[model samples]
Target: MSKIVIGKYEGTIYPEKGGYTGALALGFGPDGKRRRLKRKGRTRSQVLDRLKAAVVDLETGVKSPANYNVGEAVEDWLAKGLRGLDDDTVVNYRSLAGKHVIPLIGKVRLKDLRADDVGEWLDGLAGSLSSRSLRLVHAILKRAIRQAQARDMVIRNVAELVKTPKGTAGRPSRALTLDQARAVLEAAQSSRLHAYVVVSLLTGIRTEEARAMQWDHVVAQADGEAGWRPVTADGFEHEKFAIYVWRSVRAHGDTKTEKSRRTLELPGQAAEALRRHHARQAAQRLRAGEEWRDHGLVFCSTTGRPLDAANVRRAFRLITRKAGIGESWSPRELRHSFVSIMSDSGVPIEAIADLCGHSSPAVTGEVYRHQLRPVITRGAEVADAVFGPGKSA
Candidate 1:
């Protein structure tokens, strides 16, 4: 049995109501504030361990007298502050909070939490999350704390002072070469995602945009007699055989940006695959009869429901494996492959930006231009002419 100290601050051991070992600690906080902390544990050592921490908290005045925890703050922001966000964004924020923030630091009282505590917590996650994901996690905590501060609930947002730790380097993003793109297309021709692969690879449409494509948005023919064609100042037709990228699978069916709503010219491969897919879907609908749910999504399951992203990823991996390509790829990578292929084929960045519905050409150059290998040796020759003979190249 442990001896109880005679001082005003000491730890004591006792039996709880269930006959389990319990610990209680009496301590003096800052400015002679008396504090009593209690805890129950499976063993005497465990109870004493908690009492030690309580003593430390009392000594340092680290235990804030605030009424709320981090979890309450995060949940409040998620429920009230995210009222107008996209469904996917809200889902992602909820997942980040639940998976990272809540379990680790949720119970810490608002005023008790310090920047050092948050820094240490984030530093502990360096091995599990990637740099991009770490940024997102930091953003989530910071936004939640700021929201709480705005309501006068908390005096300070400690999360703002904590820097995001550099997380593990993520997988290097890559795009398929021209030959690999063709191979992927050939393999996908026999798969159910043929239309999706064709549309994404050829048109550079985002996976979200393609996933939300509907039959009404697809325009197979261009109007000739009605003079509805777009013309420049020089009087030239811009494009034909188009699809209106008017919506995505997000909540309320909104695109990523205003420029993301432009029309796209359907290439030959995309049009052919879409035509065949239409026939196949019609047959599937006939077979399903009354069991089919018609949500009017172009790329859907046999039951006519929208395709789940995970299911599509799994299916795409199967296709890539069958094509003798490595299976470490996602559907969104196909758009990158499209951008790379276009850049390599000498398509101007401005034109590619227009085709891909980017807000500006600068973004296209910044993201894809340098990453792509040029098919022509002209630029290399010019560099050689300007910089003398290369010592190694």
Candidate 2:
């Protein structure tokens, strides 16, 4: 950055346009090297106004050094900015900065950056990112730039002046039909994850919720006239099995949300699966002897260690492929399938929402709109009835 000077400097005055001549100010930088600052405007007054601001910046020492590059600033923030945050969050932020932000404009000097540079960088990412992912990338960049601005590293945050372009849509959530769900469950009967699959698909429990399950959470409700079945149902006197969704394997071993702590009655198949799985796990524990960890988790490996995501996913895919279901499905989609199945069976939306542990009916309705298609058809039906199909027109 150039120091403020007292005298006018020589510059070219263009004759083609009636405006302020392009001008310059001559001075010595902090390093004692000759420096020239340039400016132009639609009018001499406009040009002078900018020159005045530059002069103030130089006098007050607001101008940052031109040598500091974007890479240094972003790396500094990544190394020092994140404190007291979750380890997973730090890892994700670091990955995003390294993979997306640093490689592109890391070499550009902070003083040389412009709004257009930020815009072009984000626009180029549209080919590889989804709209949601682009927002995350933009947020990381904007936050890093803000950190620089707060410390007087840059005059302005160029990233804040740009908008992220909408990129590709994210993956569409899919649910299996009842037949496909049944097939997968049947195939899982031979796998170690049989109980986990049965609990998730039949009860609509979250994968995390299921992973955090303990044997103690499984309860047998005493048989009343309407054990778990409604008073009007034929099997009113049957015994009921339920699982208390009181915890998950989150950072603190808590459920995802307050409402997510629910108690759901399990179907007979899920109950039977758990019974068989408990016996199998006990046998494995004896065979492993002292190698068993004994976390008391309902789902575990052969040595009684708690199950991880990779374990469940591999087992899930294996059963899915065996059942002739597509190999692309995830365990979370079981909840979606549950919502769709209940919606198709004419269960009230609020009832389904309660079963799924959502905060409200609206939340369930919004997230599972694909499952609630039957309810939405009423609007079209009413419109058709009112207009008589537009035949009169």
Candidate 3:
């Protein structure tokens, strides 16, 4: 063995088995303990090169082991980084990571991962995924790599350098026409989900918000200057009603946003349906007797348990089928229909935004762009009056 010096560190190169091995004593670490670096190669120069690389890795603070891989990093993040998120959200992230990220580049070593590798992975997924899904999966990888970087598991986030490629267009959201909306409302008249459909379609509240509604949140106009009282209040009767959109089925039972915590006056149809629903629920409570689990939610199963999205969806589809519309419709579309009906009635975008609990009209315009009528018919009418009707050339 011969002593070799590289920078301030001292090491020796010696023959081991069929290859040369280099061992270096790098000074004490922050823990006051000696740190050593070792490398093995077929030749002295190769061993020296590896030892130099190791020295650089130690200096740069990127000492991730050669075997630490992207899959491990993603799983680590899924385990730790997703804390405090909703259960459904955590499940969704894990599902996306398992399906798209792990299967594609999970085996790639974190140290060796490159921007080109990430870009190529995204390009490969472009054909199979929608643009939104592509962005979500890309964000998952970038965040996972970021988590690893914070732990010194990798030098940099390679996933951040790669641009998310465009993917296939997703299915565009659809709104029911006036005739269809009317038919759907009429069909819901006989179903148990009548009030659910009416409140969702007319009030533009999220399905989660609708399900989380409590009996206390539903208020009726009070006598004189008293304002309002809960519909469940003794001797309550009123022509006008309103609901406090103060909660949702999301984690912590919070609304989607601060602005989403609003109060909306109920339409005649919604208020009437809710009144009928309350009466029906009383009968249901009597029937269930001791079996009812009184959550006080405005909408619940016959057992008085809060209704889940699957319950709403299944019931909504049956109503849609009875309305002569296809069963492909979802409950979320009722909110879209609310925006559509409002826009078609020439309601201002700002007013519609407020009703939908949007932070701004821009959100309303962008999300429900297809349903909004932005063109001014007055200009055409004025032009027709000024220039008369011109013949086509």
Candidate 4:
């Protein structure tokens, strides 16, 4: 047994239960009551270390409990930090936290978590996860720790100090060639998804945007100065049509980005397909009678319910298979196909970017780099002309 004086407080260290215990009075609390902190460890030095940490925490206004662990902080962030986010996004973050973060370091005390610990955890995941997934997991951990730090739970965010390790490469996005696109279009001509496939491939709208499209957004030219009217309007007749891309299936029915909200003129093929599809839908609605629910979505199931992404993918695969393109193709590739076709047809980068609802041409170039063709080839021809077909000497 011994006495330790830390600043003005006289503390005592005593042997208890085969371990050393340290106790100190940390002055009066806000409620005018005396406050104290205690630390116990297997050795006197260990007890001293804990006592010192407690004193620093007290001085710094940190109110985190000694038993607080990583899992608790992650759960707190998951519960509060994810408010107002899309439901799918919330679910994804929760799934990642549950599967990767909580299971591995959940038991580690928040105070004891270190940059080395985070680095090691990410490295362990690098072998199994894709680089994109690893980055997302790392971001989740960093954000969780940041939330804890804001609440004075931890001194610093160790996750932020550690860099995300490179993981396995994800599958590279590919676009259908012109011939394959034609084949797919032909195969879809007789299917219920004909309009969906045509619109997605020709307009380059995101699958989420397509799924959320409402019939009210589909407008056609009218005779007045303010000429646009929804096709659903009575006596609607127009040679030209367009759609207002205003919303998506995301939580709260908002589009993905401000730039994602745009008006796109429908290609002739897409418009024709949609006209036929609308007629077919009206017939189906009559058949379903009271069973049909009017969500007002342009694309829906037999009962007018919104189509699930999984079901859309399954139906899309059947069309690709029928076109002899195999079943591995996804609906998103239709957008990529649009970019590739437009690029190959000599569309300007900026025009293509706007058409695809991208924020900028640079973003389009970066994302669809594989699909964009070099608009300039005269440089090589001029060089060849200047070189005069020179032979190597």
- Candidate 3 segments exceeding 4 Å error: 1-7, 12-22, 28-34, 38-53, 186-192, 234-236, 249-254, 279-295, 300-311, 374-393
- Predicted model with the maximum TM-score: 4
| Per-residue alpha-carbon lDDT of candidate 3 for residues 239-259, written as tens digits (9 for 90 to 100) | 667899999988888999999
TM-scores vs. true structure, each candidate: 0.71, 0.68, 0.80, 0.81
Q: Which order, best to worst by TM-score?
A: 4, 3, 1, 2
Cα-based RMSD of candidate 1: 10.5
lDDT of model 1, residue 100: 91
Q: Summarize candidate 2's per-residue lDDT along 1-62 as a digit string, tens digits.
A: 22333345443433225665444546678999978665567866566666665555566566
Clashing pairs in 3: none
Comparing 1 and 3 on TM-score, the stronger one: 3
Deviation in Å, model 3, residue 127 alpha carbon: 1.5
Q: List the residue pairs that clash in candidate 4.
A: none
lDDT values, one for every candidate = 0.74, 0.74, 0.85, 0.85
lDDT of 1 by residue, 344-390 (tens): 76666677777777899788777776555444322212222322233
Relative to the unseen true structure, what is the C-alpha lDDT of residue 352 in candidate 3, on a scale of 0 to 100?
79
Give me the overall lDDT of model 1: 0.74
Cα error, candidate 1, residue 43 (Å):
24
Candidate 3's TM-score: 0.80
lDDT of 3 at 49: 91
